[model samples]
Target chain A: MAREASVSEVLLDARGIAKSFGGVQALRDVSLTIGRGEIYGLIGPNGAGKTTFFNVLTGLYSADSGEVQFDGARLDIGLPHLVTRQGIARTFQNIRLFANMSALENVMVGRHLRSHASVIGAVLRNRATRREEADIVDRAHRLLRYVGVDARANDLARHLSYGDQRRLEIARALATEPKLLALDEPAAGMNATETASLRQLVESIRADGVTVLLIEHDVKLVMGLCDRVAVLDYGEKIAEDVPDRVQRDPKVVEAYLGGALA
Target chain B: MTTLEGKRRDPRVALAGTLLLAVALALAPFAVGAGAGIAWVRVIDFALLYIMLALGLNIVVGFAGLLDLGYIAFYAVGAYLYALLSSPHLAGAFPSLAPGLHWPIWAILPLGALVAGAFGVILGAPTLRLRGDYLAIVTLGFGEIIRIFMNNLNRPVNLTNGPQGITQIDPIGIGGVSFGRTLDVFGIGLPSVYLYYYLFLGATLLVVFVSIRLEDSRIGRAWVAIREDEIAAKACGINTRNIKLLAFAMGASFGGVAGGLFAGFQQFVSPESFTLMESVMVLCMVVLGGMGHIPGVIFGGILLTLLPEALRYGAGPVQTALFGKVLVPPESLRMLLFGLALILVMLYRPAGLWPSAIRRREFAGAGNSPENGAGSERE
Candidate 1:
């Protein structure tokens, strides 16, 4: 709410987005406006199109009809790498680290778009390429330390603890230096302690000036952390307001209760 | 970890190791001469060529995880290019080309590699959406298509000279030193095979160096990332399509250079040399050694090449000695033993004889932790 009072500009404006998969409408006219430097939470029950919207925003799935304008320019819908290049980095609900690479190497891979090393430069190991590679390693190490996974820098991603792996994924996403960091279920399987630390980490990331769009099932965390919250049910945005107001909305309550009387 | 050993080794130790390796390689033919016929030196030369081919293929199948079963098509493209440019076949087919091109070795090598790389890109473009088994099948079909084209291209235009292939191709030479003839270096007669061995050794070393450089570079990391998980790689801002195409082109160029060297070494090339079995053999070398590890891949190539030859020589003698009469022909017996060896390796060492440290850890840590995630890594 402190950040919401100062929120004057929108970082991401996705309008009239719709997606369907073989007779099932996954998302319908779903729109979202995330403010700069604010933690925005999207909460929904099972099959409420929360993930579908995330997928469409991050370019994993093409929207049937929509326009996403991020940081002023219109975003291309279905090219995932381009989406990352355009300053929006995302983490999957199921962690998708490069399992064979070291944690440090995984973060270095995320720094790929920021670095400029051509094939000739790589094969020759020119001075510029060497310097860039060194910078990449240094940055990756710092990111691991930031995510509290520096001790596991040399460990393969698959070998990391589940909570540590989640942290590493966040570190990798941060390596992209995104204007918007979209996390899909960052606290999905964490213990209470892990979730608490994750909440702090999210707060720190937002403090670093990167806008965060969180999709979480933990209602308490969303209410406590988000400056504003949006609720989706049956492919529609039922409520979008500050956490207190959205929490008290009768429509949101009915939607969460399966809308039996609707 | 052992992966960092090469970078962390003492300079003196590394230099000494290199010198020792050079001495052993320089004397390898003589060492073989002491035990067997000099023809084995030619076999070793071919083995070096195969090492180059295997390393190249490793980029596609091992590093990028593209599973290019049609890799030999690039080799064929290079060999045919060298043959057409360096041989009198072109003149025989067309009166306008009476003098023939007869391009120099330096010009032909790069040209062959470029043409072959272009072919690689051509093969890679449409197959970008494929992975694993489907990619393998498409590549297999592509390889056969090239072979069949070479076999019948003599009809309308005598480019490949039909199945008979181009003969009397020019041998590679440099400044009065021809690899086709023996040379007296310091009064120690270096036979043509030994000379070709040195040339092929230098070429293989260059290829090895390139492969090493590629494996540790940013591009190499992108390749390995794609191999590990394509979707994850894309999420990390890697353009998977371009990276995949680059792998194909780079891998094919190496194959092309090897093919050109092969033509120059044999002074003749036929469609028979570029068979599906040849591609399978090179792939076997990669998988048998260690898919992505350079030293492992080199070991795999040498072992596979020499093991079959060793079996060929020993099979007949052992059969006659054991039974007091010839039981099975050495040719068939050699293949049988080779197949048995491959099966045994796959059964016991599914990660290969010398897997990369990462893969080795994966196999070792399998089922040890509930969060191992090894189940998703069943490649």
Candidate 2:
């Protein structure tokens, strides 16, 4: 299901990525390639190292061994902010919005890397800073509208419904204008209607030419919406292929429902 | 659409309301009797100074979520900077630089702020990784270190004049107009306290303006974002280290300016002035008023500063009325009442007397509201 253009040009490529915490090997030799404009899915049972792999890819946890290449350059996974500046943005499994800030301000905070206003500029409120601030507010509003949360733009993120908070988090991530956007369990605790809208939102996001790599628990959602799906079980990739083939793989089935199925 | 519309107010109305409040505050000194007016002005002057300190601390604790318990160190640095530059002690210590050139308050103000800011960055750089209680402990230690240095630094160099402190500090004056003396303006002789009041008011207004501008800017948003969630803020491309340091430096600069003013008004500087209790009092103002809210902090500063003084005045009369004879001295009763008031405020209004709207909503604990559920579905 990968598009022809995406197939030829990979956006994110991880090779032999591994991480360990003390004696526990959280991630082991996980490798994957996400092409430009493709919606890649990562799925695994609880404690299967899916999140650990995401953390390594996003530079939250330093990989013990491996290299991650984004847009054909060796990604220097330094600080999380530096990784974001390199054009990869991510959301958390547990939504981490700036709860005290308004929805618009939350998105504007996402524009921090792109904006050039300094403390002096802010204190002085110069013409350039004012103009840039206006642009930020306008862009923030547009992003809120894009995520269908514009009506709640003035509302505090914490005051928003759980589903709206998820959407707002996505909007904030999009405000970074990333080449690759990663979502971690975006559909968790969402109703069927909310999940359907989320799927559509992801499709629209991909249509905007932003590549997406998502970790989801809903196998049906992944199978239906993803261009390719990768299955992880016990810190290793058990299957990586087009969603239909990956879903039918014996290892994937066994990982989901015990060894008796295998 | 209805909710958004409901939240909107006419800009003109808000402007008018603010202008009216400013006018009332400006005229308040003149409205009182002469002696009471002087006393009121003195109270207001200290209140303004405390407001500046609280605003500065707000940047660190309220905006960046850095619990700083030793913020008075910066205040002490500013005061001592002013003291050293504009006092005879400098000449007394170094005879070569004798007839020590006393700098004008205007000149010393920025220098004090800059020196305090430098110290702030110096203190902040090492403790960037420490959060919450650990950060508080480091800052508390930093404050005590500055105080101890001020107390004992008279031996070799006589920098701070030991426990004797630096005195004979020059009062601030511009040309013929001196803030320390009564000035005849249009047939009426204005008290020096009135002049000090106006000076302090102007300084307060400037700090308030700067604080409001910073609160609404990208930097302010970054600080608040860091405060709310540092990990998420960093992932969103905010350099948390630099931002947190900036918060400290900016906050310290304000404390420095306030310290300079304290030196000028009192014409004295002592290590005893900048104690741990002083730092705690300023933090209480921020917490009791409402953290991160400018108007609330200003109100907190004024209320706390004046409350103890007010209690001191009323204690004797109240004690006489209650017991027919004074059982406790007014000074002791004042502290007792002040402590009781703080305890009550904390117990009843933990968020603050006047909390920021976000804080109010957070403490309201209505996250699972049905209206929000319906609102999300509408989107």
Candidate 3:
């Protein structure tokens, strides 16, 4: 399959990544590269270890044997916060906003790594910390507005509607100012209208210069949005190419439609 | 627009209410006569101390959502630190150290808080990964360990004086204004209790202000995020390990400061004072007030502290009026009434007397969307 035009400069390189959970070989010899500013799609049927790969990339899990390089340095595995500090941010398959916190506060949490206000600073509310705090609030508001949830900025995150919640999650992720943004099932349970807006949101995120790695079950959305797509089946990469070619790949068709249908 | 108007009006009303409450608290001693004033001051002193403890525990259990059952251990550490640094009893054990040179109370207070905070870090470092009941059990064990050591640590050198505890502890004072003695303020001869009442009031207010600042800060949001979902919090670039330890240490520092104040007021330090019941009572204050909400915790602390004593005083009159003589003793009746009050509060207001806005919404069932995964995925 031919490479997409935007896939020239690699941003995230994973080579020979493998993982096993006790007796279950969850992933074996899986590898993929995401180019800078490219909308990369990772698509597979259920139980194809898509989430497992995401977990390994985000440092929630350690690959049994492999290496992941992000921004030209070896990415540390098994320390999720460190991975985030290294400029990789992610949203969960299930929305995990701080339910009790206001939407603005939820986004400010993403600025945790960026802001250096100490405990003493927080308690004292000194000039510098106050300035930093004001900046955080302003930036958080801007992020909310960008994600189309600024109207509910003061509302508790859990109180937001489903589409608003999804947008708020995206806003929180963006607040971290990551070099790479990984989103898992951003359009899950969304209506057609919501999905259309989400598409615009994803494009805007990429337009803001953040590399996007998306895991989605919506084939049409992936095919339309991703610059390059990787298809996984039985814990191994079957095809890696432009969306159209990956969709037409014989192995991908057999994996999804079954050998009889293919 | 109606909701916006209501939201805009809330802070003004809350501010005015807070001012009213502050004025009432300041004049409370004078509202009662001299004889009753002293007694009320003493009760208020203890209540303020409990409020400080509750606020500290709220950082760990409320904001960070870490269940710490051994929080009293830090209090004990602070109390004993103050006792050791300022008491003459230590002079007898370490003659060369010149323990007779008691540090000033103001100086020792911060020292006590620091020492207690250090111990908190020590306790938290190893237990950062533990959560819920497991974390609680470990903390419970830590509390028992501290108590057991204080009870039997007279070996080799007699450090803590074993179960007899430390006495002749120096009282807190500044220059000529000693809290242990009556002071003439503005031509009025104020009682020692009055001085302590004012001091405790100031300390309680400081703690409340700090708690409020913390609740509104970025770190506070990170703490709430950690509480909601640790994995998500980490993915958001929050160092969960350091934040959890910070919560423990910060909470312990408050406990420590209160313990120092406790030592100064009581002029004694004993293992019996720091018990599992004290930790549970402080926790009850946080829960009954409202977890993660500062004002709710304050209300909880005051109500729980005063209710038992109030019931004790009422029981005597209650018994005398009901049976012409003492039918049931005041102590037994007081306990029964206290238990009944707590049960009633829990049954009627499960979220708390004054729950945080979020908790109030939760209890009202305002934000439960099935697609949001509100129920199944909560940590």
Cα-based lDDT at residue B370, candidate 2 = 14
Cα lDDT tens digits for candidate 1, A72-181: 99987899899999999999899988887889889998988999888789888899998998999999999999999999888888889999999999999999999999
Off by over 4 Å in 3: A1-6, A260-262, B1-23, B33-37, B98-101, B366-379
- Tens digits of lDDT, candidate 2, B1-379: 1122237789999999999988987777787435475687778778889999999998888787788999999989988888888878788779987876578888888898888899999999999988777889999999999999999999898889998888888887877577888889899888877788789889889999899889888889899888778778877988888998899999999999999989888989899999999999999999899988887898899999999999998899988999999999999989898999999998888788998777777677665431221122100
- Every model's DockQ: 0.69, 0.60, 0.62
Candidate 2 overall lDDT versus native = 0.86
lDDT of each: 0.89, 0.86, 0.87
Off by over 4 Å in 2: A1-6, A260-262, B1-19, B33-37, B367-379
Model 3: what is its DockQ? 0.62
The local lDDT score (0 to 100) that residue B168 gets in candidate 1 is 89
Candidate 1: list runs displaced more than 4 Å.
A1-6, A260-262, B1-7, B368-379
Indicate the residue-level lDDT of B230 in model 1: 82
What CA root-mean-square deviation does each model show from the true structure? 2.4, 4.2, 2.9
Model 2 CAPRI quality: medium
Per candidate, the number of residue pairs that clash is: 0, 0, 0
Clashing pairs in 3: none
